[model samples]
Target chain A: MTPQLEILITVVIVSSACAALGVFLILRKMAMMTDAISHTILLGIVIAFFITKSLTSPFLIIGAACMGVFTVYLTEMLKRTRLMAEDSAIGIVFPFLFSIAIILITKYAGNTHLDVDSVLLGELVFVPFDRLVVFGRDIGAKSLYVMGTILLINMLFIAVFYKELKLATFDAALASVLGFSPVFIHYALMGLVSITAVGAFESVGSILVIAFMIGPPVTAYMLTDQLKKMLILSILIGIVNAIVGYWISAILDVSIAGSIATIIGITYLFAFIFAPKRGILAMIHLRRVQQIEYAVKSLLFHLYNHEGTDIEKEESNRHSIYKHLHWDKRFLERVLKKAARRDYLSVNKEYLKLTPEGRKYAIKSYEVL
Target chain B: MMFLESLLRDYTLQIVALGSVILGAVSGILGSFAVLRKQSLLGDAVSHAALPGIAFVFLLTGVKKTEMLLLGALISGLIGAFIIISIDRYTRIKFDSALGLILSSFFGLGLVLLTYIQKRPNANQAGLETFIFGQASTLLKRDVYIMIALGGIILLVVGLFWKELKLFCFDCEFGKSIGFSDTKINLILSSITVLAIIIGLQSVGVILMSALLISPGVAARQWTDKLSCMVILASVFGMVSGVVGTLISSSVAHMPTGPVIVMVISVIMFFSLLFATKRGILWRYIKTRRDSRDINECKILINLYESALNHEEVRHAHKTTMLKPIKSLHYLRDKGYIRRDYLNTWVITDLGMEKARNSIDKNRGERV
Candidate 1:
């Protein structure tokens, strides 16, 4: 495969794996934990490298993965004390651990290939050079195989435990009552998140891992409510982000991972503005519509309440609502027009009257209120 | 003594240490409010978000001056803070998701801008990466002055608003009910926190700045229950870590000052977690052990007293298998709580009866 294709494939696999786990994380309200894990895993990898003296050793992966879990463990331990909130707990632990790793790398391992820069901003341009060869047959980039395997593991884990995970995520108490250990499931999922973070670290670095893990899932969440659909949509969104981000980076000659993160941010922005039910636009429109309906109903109630009374003869008029209800002229006109179109009320010269249907609607609204 | 002498005599070391100490103390004071408000990660978000401002200022001016870059960082950090607050207020997305989104996206933009600058022939971006992993040793006397000025301003603001901030954190609803605008207090508090983060950005960098802000407060929490005391202790912890970390890193080759400081604070936090008087793990463990031991001892004494009440003599052979073994009875005998009579049965002494009565009273009090 071409180098571009290789990079794209690897990015997609990593993004999808992260996005899938992100679905669970978002549902579990543990999305920021990915950021914490991504960072603290560096300390794990650095310590592991110090012991084995080889970056390629599986011990590095194990060590980094252990640090990821350790980050979660420490965050939880701090949170359990009730002295601080969850985010504070995370904010405290990861940086302390990550700083340790950076210091260690810059101090003892400075002469080596290890440094804080590459750990935080992995170069995709270098991925193609490190190809895996089995029995003298050249294969794809090492990142591709590594990320591919991680994606498979994520898929398999989610698939097998989908029901239990869904149950635990949505209703932990009920799941526990049904014999599923919510805490066990929680740690297991965290373990998978750790492994995925470790796999993605070398390719995308840590910050973008948070981007891919949280962005697509949250965007999908804004777009949909169903878990199954959210998972699928997030994966699809991740693939698009990977592919589009790759091309943009290629054209602009910029950091591929960074471009990918920027693309996901843009995607989230769009979802935030334009998603059908939960989007800002929809919410505004819904509020506006509700306001109009409310104005019309209250107008009808006003007419109904004052009907056949001397007060109605004294104060009730078509233009009086603008003064009495303290509504703007434009708002009153709009409400009047809507109410007339709906046959809820009619205007006769100077006074307004509610139709029988409008009377019923007014009474119902009053009863409900 | 030598370390203290070197700390005072070495001008460069003194400048760096002074800068770190100010950064640590300010971060600690603001961090307590941040941690209590559950906005601990805001420091992380705002600091990371400040990166773009640094890059933008460097790009626009082609200068790498500390104050100018920090101005840009402050603006950017405030913008990031604004984005987080707006996202939270405007959208259904939770605070955590909004934080992660802003943090990664802003940092990503920063990386892009940084790389863009690095590619330019005119931009000498060698020192730019220092803001990611801070190099405290690189700080100049001028930078220290700037930090001190900023730190003083921050401390002044905190001191002046101490009562309002305390009420705002402890019970915001009460503060609001009493005519303090919660929104205004929140805005002021958030602004100060971002400022504290921006001042520390050059010393600790973005990644670990949150640690500077958060760890001190957490450690201090273990040692005190009062907010004012916690804030004071946190600052003290922060200052100690700053001095010690700077000294240690200066003595060692290639040791980064920021992480070393973080490491020192972390050590303090760990110890506080384990050994603080009121809420430390060690004290809680000791209390648990002591309470259980008291119950066991009380049970044994009460059983012996009951056996004596039933019969003229409390026989060691009496079926009190539910109680501790015969060795405990022997232990009570040795302690003079029980005496072996002519029949080889255990008899409660007057002192033992009084002890049993006290134990029963204590148990009853606890139940009540």
Candidate 2:
């Protein structure tokens, strides 16, 4: 296969894995923790490289996963201390680790091919060039295999423990009484998150890794209330972002990771504005239209149901009534036109008459109002 | 020691250290309010959000003065914060989601702009990259004076509004009920936070400055419960980290100062997490162990009572046999809760009887 096809396949696989595990992270409010893991993984990979003396060593994934777990452990430890909240602990721990990584890279690895920039921001275009070989036969990109395996692992774990994870995530205290170990579920979910981060970082870089993990899941959450629907939507969103973001970057000659992140952001914005139930714009429009409809019906009903005056004079002197009601003139005219179209009122040179159907409708509205 | 003295003698190093001290103290004072309000992450988000602002200013004016760039940064940072607050107020999205959205977008925009600027032919754009990860070694005497003046003004304003800030942070509704305008207080607090970020940006940069703000406050929180003392202790911690990080970075060749300062602050936070008396990991561990032991002892006492009631000869179960269980009974007796008779049997003393009755009463009362 061509290198472009290989890169596209690799992006799809890695993004799918990230999106799959991202659902749990977003639900648990651990998006920033993924950001922390992405940064701290650099320190782990660097240290592992120093020990193994090979960038391709399997220890790289193990070391990075260990550091990811350590990040969560430290966060929990700090939170239990009642001194720092979760966010502050994350803010403190990851940067120090990242700094150490940078310091090491500058001091010892500056001349080496392995540097901070490469580890932190992997080159997606060059991913296909790093081929994996089996018994002297060339296989596809190495990142594809790694990410695919992690994705399979994630799927199996989620399938087997779906009920337990759902219960624990929604309510941990209740889960504990039901004989489910919340801590066990938490650690298992975090472990999956760590492995996914390590795998995706190799192809998509750290910054885009967060966007893949958080953006799709959060957008999916906004679009659906059902967990199963959310998962499906998240995967679909992830795949679409990968394909469209890659094409956009290729056409526009921009950074691949930045383009992908921007696409995810745009998709999220779209969901925020257009989702049927929760969309902000939809709700605002619905409220305004309802208000306008109510105002028109109320004006027509009052004109038809006057108790002490002739309806003709009242309709002719609409402006005098408008002064008392303090309603806008344009609004009054629009309501009058709507009433005439509905056969509720007929307007002629500022005089009006109501039909029998109009009188009945007016009485119903008057009683309801 | 002599090498340290020689290192401190360098004018550039001295100036950077002094400037970092001022920056650290201001951040500490403002961050106390941020942490109390559960808006600690706001500092991080706003600082990252300032990147686009700085880049836009540079793009438009071709100016690189610290004051002009920071002014643009403050405006953009405030805009970012406003967006975050508005999203939180208007949408169903939680504060965390809004924070993530603003942080990523603003920082991404900044990065795009910075990359564009790098491709241009402007030599002055060289130090602009330092704002990502700061380098304090380049600070001059003028920067030091500016930091001191800014730090002093922030501290003075914070001092004057200390009581109002406390009321606002702990309970805004109550503050409003008592005739305080929560909106005005919030404006004051946020302005101080923005100023603190601007001053510290020159020293610790954007990404790591939030760490500087929050870590010291966290450490101080472990040490004290009072807000006033916590603020002072946090300032001291921040100052110490700044001084040490600056001194070390200057002594070592090619060491960036921002990360070192963050590392130093993290170390203090680590220590506080483990060792603080009022609220620390070690204390909680000890307290939990002690409580567990007390629970086990109560369980054993109740077990003995049940077993004694099962005896056939003693109608009221006033005595027990001497077995391994009796060993614990003897131990309790030595602690002045039980008595041993000449017949090698255990019996409850008056104090022991009263204690058992009280335990039963308390347990039943709790259940009800």
Candidate 3:
């Protein structure tokens, strides 16, 4: 396979893994925690690198994972103190840890190969340079294996604990009573997220990792109601994002991670505005139709209530009805026109009179409303 | 005295420290309100959102004028803040997801633009990326003046609308009920927060700026429950960290100021959480332990007295195994509430009986 395909595959694998685990994160209202973890894991990787003094050491991944979990633990501990709000706790802890890491890099590790830019804005174009050679045999890109393992781990975790995770996410108290420790599942899920973050860190950087994690999941959320379908949809969206984002970045000669993040944002914006049922435009359209329907029903009711009454003329006049109903004159006219078109009311001598069909319609609306 | 003399002699140090102090003080004041209103993450989103603005401005002007770039940032940050508000308010998306989405995507766009500008033949040294991890030691005197002016304006706005802001932070529904427009008040609050963030960004950078906004507010919260005191304490914390962080970074080789300031403020937050007088973990733990100990002693004495009354005997021996609060038993003996009668038993003294009766009467009275 060519290098471009290899890079694309790396991105897709990373996105799929992130999006898969991200479903549970967003459902648990932890999108921001993922943000906190992604940034803080840099600190962990730095510390681990210092210990092992090797970028390729497995300890870096382990340290990143540990630090990700530690971020959640510290935020929760601070929140449990009830001295500050939850988001404030996250805002405090991650920056503190990340700052320490940055400071360490700037002051002590400046001479090392580790560059802060790579930590923030990872360059996937360099993927072809780092080939995995096993026993002097040429293999694939190293990111392929790392991200693939993370992807498999995420899938296995979701598959093995599907029911438990579902129960725990929706209702933790009941899940706890039913013999599944939600706390354990929670920590385990966070651990996987951190691991995925570490694996993807090289390919997409820390900040863009959030785009992969949350973008596809939220977009899927906009498109689907079923959890299984949402998870599958997010994975597909992640794949598409990786492909489209890579192409855009390649064409523009810009940052691939940035392009991918922008694509994710645009995709979610599209879903937000144009999804069939839940999209903003669709809801707005539904509200407009509902408004006209309700207004016509109001006209029917008003005409039916005053039918053959002493004040029927005074109440049923279109110009006067707007005032009586506290609606705009133009709106009352629109409602009147709608009622007449439906044969629910007849206008004669500038006063509305309910038709025989109109009387029945008013009674039906009364029952339904 | 030597340090003070050095501070006076060093022109760049004076400028950077002064800028950091102003940035810290204003952000701290506004951050207290943000923390109370649960908008701590808003500053993070706004700061990141400002990046595309700066880069875009530089792309257009081809010159890195701080004021022009900051103006672009202000516009961009406001738009980002508005989008976050709209997403959270109109859609089913929660506040946190909206924040994370906006910050990352905007930062990414900024990166794309920065890289784009760098690739241009005439782009020259964009140096635009430095805003990500701001170098406080490079702050100019003009930047310090801008920070002071903006800082003063923020302070004045906060003072002028103190009552409305307090109402908005603690009780928005009540404020709405009393005829303050919720949207208007929210606009004022977010505007000040955005300005404060803009002022701090050049010193602390985008990523750590949130810490500057949140840690001081949270640290001050541990010290006091009142909003006025909390805001005052928070600004003081911010200034101290700013000054100290600057001093330390200036002394150390290859040290960037933003992270050091973040580290210093975090230490302050950690200590505040640990040792604050009212809400600190240590204080609460001690209070709980002492309360439990008192309750245990009261129960042991009350048990001896009740058993004596039941047996119709002045001296009733109780098993040491049954009354298992060994430490409380020793304390009761020391307090003259009970006495050792046998190897495995103890009896309530007259003093213990009277005390238990009075305590039981008081409990009954309170319940009634």
Structural similarity to truth (TM-score) of each candidate: 0.90, 0.79, 0.94
The list of candidate 1 runs beyond 4 A from truth reads A291-359, B176-181, B294-319, B325-368
What are the per-residue Cα lDDT tens digits for candidate 1 across A1-369? Answer: 998888888898999999999999987889789989989888899999999999789999999888888899988998887656888789878988887787888778877887678768778888788899999999889999999999999999999999999999999999999999999999989998999988888888888899998999989999888999999999999999989988988887788877888888889989988889888899899999999989988888788888999889555687666898889999999999999998988788898888898899899989999
RMSD of 3: 2.6
lDDT, model 1:
0.86
Clash list (residue pairs), candidate 1: none
Candidate lDDT (C-alpha), each: 0.86, 0.78, 0.89
Residue-wise C-alpha lDDT for candidate 2, range A96-138, written one tens digit per residue: 7887887787677767787554454457888888888999998
Report the first chain's TM-score for all candidates. 0.97, 0.80, 0.96
| Residue B145, model 1: Cα distance from true site in angstroms | 2.3
Candidate 3's C-alpha runs over 4 A off are A292-317, A339-369, B314-322, B333-355, B365-368
What does the i-RMS of model 1 come to?
Answer: 1.3
lDDT of 3 by residue, B102-190 (tens): 88888888888888888899886446777888878778988888888889989999999999999998999999999999778777888
Off by over 4 Å in 2: A1-9, A81-84, A133-141, A148-185, A243-253, A286-369, B1-8, B121-124, B149-164, B172-191, B252-255, B285-368
Report the lDDT of model 1 for residue B236.
91
Question: Which candidate achieves the best TM-score against the true structure?
Answer: 3
